[model samples]
Target: MEISDSKKRIEELIEQLNKFAYEYYALDNPSISDKEYDKLYDELTILEKETGYILSYSPTQRVGDGILSQFSKYIHKGRLWSLDKAQSFEEIIEWHNRNVKAVMQYNKENADKLPPLEYVITKKFDGLTLNCTYDNDGIMIKAATRGTGEIGEDITAQAKTIKALPLKVDHKGLFEIHGEAIMTKEAFDAYNEKAEVKLKNLRNGAAGALRNLNLKETAKRNLSAFFYDVGYNEGDPFESYIDMMKFIREKNFPIDDYMKIARDTEDIKNEIEYINSIRADLNYDIDGIVIVINDMRTRAVLGYTIKFPKWAIAYKFEAEETTTELLDVEWNVGRSGRVSPTALLEPVDLGGVTVKRATLNNMDDIKRKNVKIGNRVFVRRSNDVIPEIMGVAEELENAREIIAPSNCPSCGSELMLVGAHYFCENTLSCKPQMVKSIVHFGSREAMNIEGFSEKTAEQLYEKVDLKTLSDLYKLKKEELLNLEKFGDKKAQNLLDAIEKSKECELASFIYALGIPNVGKKTAKDLCKNLKSLEGIKKATYEDLLAIEDIGEIVAKCIIEFFSDEKILRSIDELLAVGVSPSYEETLVNDQSSFMDKTVVVTGTLKNFSRTEIKDKLEALGAKVSGTVSKKTDYVIAGEAAGSKYDKAISLGIKILSEEEFLAMI
Candidate 1:
């Protein structure tokens, strides 16, 4: 075929494949079989290569070239503000009354210059918020997280993997669209079935997929996005949000049909009640309902607060609860060596999903609740995400008392009581603890070992001499192939991931160490303060206490952790095996005002959001803490500073206003 003919054919094929992908992945209805789609895709790819003519909107361009070294921050065209939450009907009424008073006074003053006020209520999706930007050419240039409202992590490549999201739209002239990236129940279960490590919840599933640098893995999650608001657009602005919704719908964007306009507070309340009744029947999870002023004029008049819009509010629903028979209690060991009880039950449908198990917390909780095996228990699911056993509902006459295990199930070691929980002190020998630790070490937020799985950890532990964490670095492809279900591609991929993890950042390496009570945030704080792993190891308890949020207990834990001879040996082994942890150079500042200071930000600030201020503090070589403590050097108080300000004042910590903070910086 001629090049001209090939180009025409490729364009047609690309269009057809895009439609097919949308139908299959987004609409959940496949018009074409996978084989046929693949055939067409292959044909188009070959034609593009042969003719040297590739369409920007081609299906092949959906997957990016390779993994990004690190995600770059993208400044949003406009700030993305959060919504104030209203938990009760009374709070909603109070907000409605305030709106009524404002609109009434405005109409009285201007003699009805503004149109009648109305509200639009839609379900609040419990998923990751994404901002998609389309340039003047109608080409999607970027998709970002709602990082700090003003700036976000660019995930354009990962966003393209969402088949529901349009790679190229018909009309774009600098449009910034807001949407929620969510994973459906079907996709979540399907992924969990094949995945070695299961996703805990749908929210995390969507968030994790987008945050992952690997576009291929992001595609595997089958994320779907529903666009709602036009945050920024150079085109003629819509008179009302409803008109904007119509425009978005015309552009073939995914918008839920559940958006309802309410004329009054009663209408709003009724709509909310209707939403609550059908929430269980919905495909995706929603934590609450968002009520916003529909008219652009009214929204402008109402304006916005520093952090949240005054014209909008979120009404959160109560936690979903159900009762089921507790058949047994299964104890699991965590990376921190803590042994926790999980209640295995007769499957009971709750909030559209069947929950067969729930976290029983600890032995103290079980004993306090008088929980027993074979007893019907009340299980509560928070936001349709985490399941927890609330208490026993019905006690069976034959119910057996739940007894705490005297010995660790994985290592046969003696169980010791630590505060309210039981722990297996044998962290090195316990299979569950060791395996979990290895898995955590290789987790996406930690060492980020690509393709790492619990099954791989189990195989390495049982079959190979993978006794210590250092043994992971010592793994060979040949030995991995000896394990069951191992393939050449899989083994090589894992090995490459292991090698890549050796060059991880200092914060991730510290987090991967699985230190007790040390999370990602704490690890970052430690790294920012200590500057290196060596500094952390050599730091005394007093030195650790100087860091933000590091109290006497946490300080003691850090000192104890580094004091362990085994941990030192493991560190030496890792270093010997060529593992190198790296840290970025400190940011240059005109004045190092906040250097070596521990700062906490409270309430809404005029210049920066909570996250942005924290990042700024960290960038300025200061440790930004979450709480007000005795170690805190300064507290940046914004409008409505609330209890943190009170606590800081009580503790005699220095307080700085937003202007004062800016001046200091």
Candidate 2:
């Protein structure tokens, strides 16, 4: 064929092969056979060689033959901010409450009211974060890691190897898109089956592929990606997150089909639960659900914290179970004087964390699970909590039974068996128990005493004989100065911090008390319902159980805690030392039209933002429902209202327009 004809054929073949690759990788729906695709690809390569006319996006250039000497640094067009994390429903609720409060405060102060809070929920992909830059011609120029969020190592060659990623697009815009480069289970298993060195997990598989110097080795992993955000855009500004997502879809970027809009904490919780349930069955891995403010305006208002975006949070799911050999067992005493067995495990990576130790609960748990030294035990980690041994995964021939220690690990005191737990009754002399109690009392979420450390707590426990919780308040500059590394400035600062801790929130005070089964959220719930420390002290079993999130066990624990004479005396002493705990009431207007009503807001509103409307309804004491159901008292319909609006009309629920809602309020 002539050179001109070869060039023309090359262009056509490139387009055809690119389309086939996109269908196979991006859509997971291949229209043509692999044999046919290879035939066309071979022809394109031949034609390009004959004509010396090769496009930058040609499939032939996907994987470079030469290995890279080193990675070059590339500065990102826009900083990629990390999301604040939440592990439980309570944390999500707390984060949601903060968002609601911020929106309410902003609307109350400004003439132009902010919109209601709408969160975009997506999968928090368990992989490396990739930032891909596309030039004005819509051709991908650079791809980098989320190193420091500002600068990153160049991985353009490695990224191009991903068949799902678009090498060129049909647009004329300079932009940067954020995505997660993930290795599907299929890819991981396939690679591991033939390789000499096996991959540890899907996350490491993807991360290792992208960071590899050899392009051929990177291509062997067969990585996939899902773009979520247009981090930097120069063509057209998006009004909302939904708009940006739509733009990404239009540009033929591969995105997960699991995105949803959550209007309230309930919606978020439902989504989180759903994701957690389905994560195991998914071909790719996801560590959590990412909740982002949908509106760009709202995001701008919320802005970014020092390390994370205030408008977004990640509800991390429990880490997957992994098996590790139990090497030994060590007993430790906690703040409650309960001695628990901690299994020393052969170092294993679980959810990117090196887990060297796992909780064995107690002697009962160890016996029940049949966990023994030299046996491979199933370990699972939830959030930042210590990994727990679920059960023995594999029994070894030489495995030995885990024997319970008869004495305390800290003070060598006699251990007393209490139900399922072993306790050290010598709490007055046990150093670990006392030190831990002091540290817990001065924890950031508790009394929040600045400059408080484990070292300082140990020093106080040993040198100053800090025997009780109230003893911390009685600490003086002279006492602190006598300790090692305690200068005049350090001693003064410690004293000031201790003094400042005297005035604390009721919730903090309750949490600092170290009541068994009572966490920060539980303490906050108790403070909110009881209103005063005295009320909590006088609360009956039924009264404690009446509060939300408080179960029978927690109620019993609280009652027992207050019933203790020593605890009661400690409380009295704390009060006598000028410790004051204050509670702030969350007020609502009961007279409002939407008070205690379940209201659903849908579509775009002319006067208010999505979040603004929700916040306004919440302010009026309304429960904003994400879905339209028979329980919905009102459906606030706006322009382009879809299924929820239709469902409301069919259900014969009260419907209100923006004008009607404004008038009603």
Candidate 3:
């Protein structure tokens, strides 16, 4: 019950909960009842309320409601779309009402009166959705799902075998099809029982089924699909949802009989109510109700929201149940030296992934979660990102008192609170902070020093009187060779790699300096105009503020870096040691056609990532915005075009579709 023992207890509970999540969600074969799971969840929830512990990965924080396969990276032909969630009934109704108005507005000019239209409501299966592309020959060429709604996975080899998918579609030239890949309850149980690492739920099973190496292997699983709609087509394939269903059925798709086409809000409500009532009885997974417009053309005009389609909405089903024990809380410092705390739970399985640590943003967050050692807490991980301690469960006031850390554990420096972080004012002198800076400098993205691993850096510091990173360049090859276990070959490689990096760009050098808040991209921008180390040193804070992405924090870091006599002396010493003080900027013609225009770079490029391209373009004085807009003179499209591509075309704005964008770059 002691606070010191809390870390160990939380780790244990995390393991247990992770196992439970694996059984319940990923495997879909629960050994315990829903009520039992809730009991465990309730216990943890109560503890979180008192102790303020939040593990980064908690079962309660996860979305997908279950485990999904580690999604394979695929170059999508079109960008995968993310859906906008509706939290309240009013929000859902308001969304529909707006869509109805928009659809009417679009058709108003053509006719005297708007046609009376009703939406078709169907079950929204909880399983991941896939967009399978079929050639006219009926061969499955590509398979993707809505990943950020821009680009999706290329699961062609895996999609080739999903049973409901036909070898060929009835009408296909270049056609894009949509469907939900799902695992049935029986198959989920059987797999959980037989498999070495049991899938936690049917969703996981479906995902696993998709990633299977062999078509035969995928076929071995009882996976099914309900072909939704053909998003892309050379021509009209079906007039209505009913017609589309019949077409897919004729083509050998396994359409679920429960798919009822409900027209009118009353009918939609009735269907949603019915799905919710019998949700537990269904053989396949149904997360909620999916409402779509029967008219494909009309659906197109309705367009989409930032994340989801504005034309339709999903009414989600309530989550089943879960539980876990709260044990302790821990705190970690980030790159900016911000101390963030996390809740430690007794081991728990979430969506097939082990959950242990959840974030407690700060002292305020700790109070919000109210977590404590030896108390029960409810937790959830959302969007597979950070988990939150939702609430506390049963109380254990008899346990030893829990207390937050007063000093930084790594340096034993007294902690000072700043915003949401507990800071150690000794940024330059803190041992942990010092080594972390050195590691950042030697990183591939920062300095590109291949042989300068963290282990070597640490060892060098201990073996010699190394105070700063500049000393690394001063180490003689023979001196390194004489070090423990380091022979001539390894030492020589390290020396050569270090020598090769001396000629690195000014931006990379800036990033390597380990200045606070100066990220890679920002560093690149700093050098784009300044071009030399001395230029940065000479520039005023006002001068730095002129550059894009150089906010107040970054500007402050830049000013401080140049002002520090130690940092300045270190750089002067590095240049004296044959390092590039500043590299000459590549001469690029400013008269280029795209100059002065705002652009957005998206999707996977054959040559460069969006970041790389953005860095390169900024170096040339071109503005690249993250989001697409009217000001977006060009959107450099890559393999998969997402909503941005559609948005650009709709606005009658010029677009450098991925291929064209690549050529321009």
Top model number, TM-score: 2
Candidate 3 per-residue C-alpha lDDT over 148-205 given as tens digits, one digit per residue, 9 for 90 to 100: 5556766655554443455444455677767888888888777656655545457767
Model 3 stretches astray by more than 4 angstroms: 1-324, 332-340, 368-371, 374-402, 415-420, 425-431, 478-487, 529-531, 583-590, 619-621, 640-659, 662-665
RMSD of each: 28.1, 20.3, 24.0
The residue-level lDDT of candidate 3 at 157 comes to: 52
Ranking by lDDT: 2, 1, 3
The candidate with the higher lDDT, 2 or 3, is 2
The full ranking of all candidates by TM-score, starting with the best, is 2, 1, 3
- Give lDDT for model 3: 0.67
Model 2, position 15, has a per-residue lDDT of: 79
Off by over 4 Å in 1: 28-36, 320-665
- The 10 consecutive residues of candidate 2 with the worst lDDT sum are 642-651
> On a 0 to 100 scale, what is the lDDT of residue 396 in model 1?
90
| Model 1: per-residue Cα lDDT over 421-512, one tens digit each | 89998977788888888899899989999988999899888899688888999998899999988899989999999998899889888888
TM-score of each: 0.51, 0.52, 0.50
Per-residue CA lDDT of model 2 for 371-448, tens digit only, reads 899999888765567888877779999999888889998899999998999999887789999899889999988999
Which is the leading candidate under lDDT? 2
Least accurate 10 contiguous residues by lDDT in model 1? 21-30
lDDT of 1 at 98: 90
